[model samples]
Structure formats: C-alpha cells, structure tokens
Target: MMNCQFVFLLLVIYMLYLFVGAAIFSVLEQPYEEQLREKVLNMWDDFLEIHPCLSEEKLEDFLRTALLVKSFGVSVLRNISGFEVKWDFVSSLFFAGTTLTTIGYGHPFPISLSGKVFCVFYCLIGIPFTLSLLSIVAQKLTIFLRDRPLHYFHHRWNTSNNKLEWIHAIVVISILCLFSFFIPAIFFNFLEENWGYADALYFCFISLSTVGLGDYVPGERSGQRLPALYKLLVVGYLLLGLVCVFLMVEIFKNLLKHNQILSLFLLGYEAGRQDEEIDHVSTNDSEVPFAPRNDETTRRRVTHSASPNEKSYGSISPSRAPAIIT
Candidate 1:
C-alpha cells in the first residue's frame, strides 16, 4: 500500500515535470516555428515573382515536385530554415533528457564544439541519474503490484504461490501493454496525420525501448502547429510510457527468478553465489584456527564444529585421546 502511494506520488511529480518541460519548449520553439513558416512563404513568393510566366497551379505543382525530390535526395535544394533554429534553454533541456534516457530521436543535436563537450559531460551525470530513477520507480511499482493487486488475486482465487506469481506477472504485463503501447499507439495514430496504426505502434515500441529511430517523432511535423495542450499530452504519454515499460521489465525479471528453465539464460547466477561464498569463507577463516591435515606422520587430528551459540575446535591426540574425550 505504501509502495502504491509512492508510485502514485512519483507519477504525479513526473507528469508535472513533463508539463513544465512542454510549457518551456512551446514558449522557446514557437517563434522559430513561425519564422520557418514565414521563410517558406517568402521563398515561394520569390519563386513566383522570378517566374512570372508560370501559372499559380503550375508553380504549386513544381514546388511540390521539388519538395518531393528534396525529400528523396534527388535535388540540390536544402531546407535551410529547418536548421536555423537555435538550441535554446527548453530545447537543450528536452534534448538532454532524451539523451540521458537513451532515446536519441535525432531530430535535434549539438552542432557546436562547446555544445558537444557539454553534452558529453551532461550525459556522464544524467544517464546514471536517469537509470537510478527508473530503477527506483520499477522497484516501487513491483512492490505495489505484489502487495496490493497480487495479494488480492492470491486470496480471492485461493491459488498456489507459483500460480499466484504467474497470475501477478500476467496482470502487470497486460496493464503495461495496454497503457504503454496499445492505447498510446491509438492516440499517436490519431494525432499524427501521416502515421498508420502499425507505424504508431512501431513508434511506441521503439521509443519505449529507447531505440528512437527518429522516423516518426511526436511533434515537429511539417506545416503542423502543435497546440500547447497537445504538446503536454505527448510529454505525459512519453513519461507514462517509460514507467510502464520499466514496470513490465521488473515484473518479467521477477517471473524469471521463479522459473528454473528461463533463469538459466540469465548470466552469472552461480558465479555470483560462488563469489559471495568465497567472501564468507575468507571472513570466517580470519577468526578461526586452521585444522590439522589427516596424515600418518601427524598422530593428532583436529575437528571443527559450530553451533548457534559458539564454535569449538578440538584436537585428538592418540596418546591423550581418552582424556581429550572426557
């Protein structure tokens, strides 16, 4: 129950964080977006003025063809306005977050030497911080599911421990898939004009996995103005999607822990146990006396025994064996 509350609180804080970032990004990027739009319009007007003999319809067709050719790398005309936007505070913040999370969408990047240097240092600190934050969230989410939801299912079904564990894993995975991928994909398909259901689903999968192929970013589509509300919603979706993905991974790890066949694929299990045993033996050997070897030359033998209260080391000598026993 406490874990559930902690997850809830963390989610609330994360949503607020997304909203703050979205607000700042929208504010900083809006001017550049408008400037890019104006520049495109001015370029079109200049082209029309230069070619007065060309009809409006013909000019439109030519411009569309040019854009298509440019998109396909069949033309020399580069989209200069696209690269004119500065990496302002909000853009830098969002990029840094994405970088730390390993979701390099590649829509924006550092072009300057100083920015690249800063990026290197920023990631050194930020990646670990992001990973630790994700780990904590995943842990709390696991505890929450186990204590509240799984506990209820266990009692209600009167199931065995193994079955209950599997049931818990299934329930958590179903919820995560529904919220993180299916539902969000539906929303992304609706919001993104060019995206189909499959494309949206792929985007969600890639983004959650931090593969971030950059082919289908949420915003920044051409000729589309992202409203502040939509931007906030997208940011919220990203945060919640990441949480669900981490939660699913945590539940899957727990399931693997209970499955002998599957657990073998996990590396270093026995090696880790052996390392722990070596440490324990070393610590014990420091406090205990060495036992004598069993050899014909040494008529005395030593045996070591340990109990809850104390440990005893006894030596048996052939000459004094009777007295030693007493």
Candidate 2:
C-alpha cells in the first residue's frame, strides 16, 4: 500500500517535470521561432513580388516541394555543381546504423514508400536487439566496474557497507561519465568546428541519452571530411555510452535503496528473482524477509519467519543463520 502511494507520488512529480520543461522551453524558444517564421514569410512575399509573373500557386507548390525534399534527407541546396549526394552508399550505411541504434539524428530518414515501410519493420525488430545487447554489456561491466573493485575495497579496507556503497557510486559514476560523456564531448568539440565545447557536451548528452534532438548532430556540416567514418564512430560511441548508462542506473537504484523515501520507486521488487543467481557475498537487504536487528518489529518478524518456515534470499538455509546468509 505504501509502495503504491510512493509510485503515485513519483508519477505526479514526473508529470510536473514535463509540464515545467514545456513551459520553460516555450519561454526560451518561442520568440525566436516566431521571429524566424515571420522572416521566412517575408522572404516568400518578397520573392513573389520580385517575380510577379510567377503564379502564386506554383510558387507555393515549389516551396512545399523543397521543404518536403529537405524533410526526406534530400539536400535541396542546389549550386552550379548540383546538390550534395546525401543518399549514396556510405551515407545510407550510416543512416541504417543510426536507425538501428535509435540515435536517429532525424536528418536522413527514408522518403520512399518502400523505404519507410522497411524502416518501421526494421526498428520493430532491431530496437529490442539493441537493448538486449546493452543489457548484456552492462552486466559484464557491472562485474568489472562495480563488483570487483567494491569487493576488494570492502574486504581490504574493512570499510562499512554503507560508506563503501557511496564511494562505489561516486567512483563508478565519475569514471563512466568521463569516458562516456566528457571524453566524447572533447573529441566532438575538436572534430566539429562550428560546435563550442558546451554545444559538443550537449550533443554528447543528447545522443547518449537517446533523446536525439537532431539540433546538434555532428558530421552533417558541409565539406565535412570522412563523414561516413564520423557517423560510424558516433554509432559506436552511442553503444558504449548506453552500456555505461545502464551500469549507472544500477548504481542509482542501489543508492536509492539507502534513501527511505526514494527506495519506493523500486517498490521492493526486481525484474527477476534476486535470490537464486547470486551467492556468497553481501546481497541487498531489501531481499531479506524482514528486519532482524534488535527492534520490536524485528522480533515479531523473526517469530513470524520461524513460525512460517520462511526462506530468505541470502545463501544460507534459514534457522536464524544471519552471518551465514551474509
């Protein structure tokens, strides 16, 4: 019952956050967007005025067609040499990888009927595969980045579990953030001439978070060298970054467990059985049947457990073998 109430509160908070973000973005961006819209309208009127013999309907159709072409990732920026080839083999390969990864910069999407249909089917199958891949990697990295170091520190330093967990969280978050976000942003800053460090950092955050706002995509600049290679690198970075994010999320959940209020988000539930797979080392106390340390509730819970022959998730078989369980 308490968990349900907590979940409800979190939902309310989330909705509030969304509305606040919407209001803030509107305030920040709306005026500029309106100004741009007016400027474009004026440009259209001026162009029509300069070419009075041109039919207004024809001009409107042409404008719409140009916009549609750009929307479909076709470069409508024509010069004497013709528009850039955006759908060539390398570009298409990059587009396919981005689509599969769900980074989807929104610059190069399928325009054709068959291509769009294929895209829908491709994503239907591929997104799950991508997520599964990330999960698998996160599990492995959890062992390397989280488990081994934490185990060593706790055992060697004789540190308390609470302090060790906090240290673990801080260390893991720092190292992963450096590699996944900060380092990538540095590279992006150097590679993308128009991007400032802040812009590059924003791009890294947006891409790795899979928000893909498309406002700050790299390798899209005209005269960009080795655009295909750059896109492939971005896709690779996204996969590694996602794995780090997954590991960070586990740390986030672990830290949340320490906080009585925030712990409700987990609702004392995990996706799968926690007891069966892991053994020997300290497990989440949340998995324990009830509080066992000296207290009225603990005493009652112990009596209840003994009466019911309750099984604890901890490794040891239960008959009040707390040390063995840990």
Q: Look at candidate 2 and give me any clashing residue pairs.
A: none
- Predicted structure 2: lDDT: 0.77
Error of 1 at 61 (Å): 24
lDDT of 1 by residue, 71-172 (tens): 432334455344223254544555666678888887677756997898899889988898788878878977877667777877888887788888777877
Which candidate leads the pack in lDDT? 2
Instruction: Give all candidates' CA lDDT scores.
Output: 0.71, 0.77
Badly placed stretches (over 4 Å) of model 1 are: 1-89, 155-157, 227-232, 267-287, 290-326
TM-score for candidate 2, residues paired by index: 0.75
* Cα lDDT tens digits for candidate 2, 1-326: 54456567778989999999999999999999999999999998999899999999998899899998878766677551222577877778767767777778898888789989999998999888988888888888778877788899899999988789898899879999999989888999999999999999999888878788889867777777777778778777877788898889877777886876565355343321343335422355335555654444444434454435654343344565666455
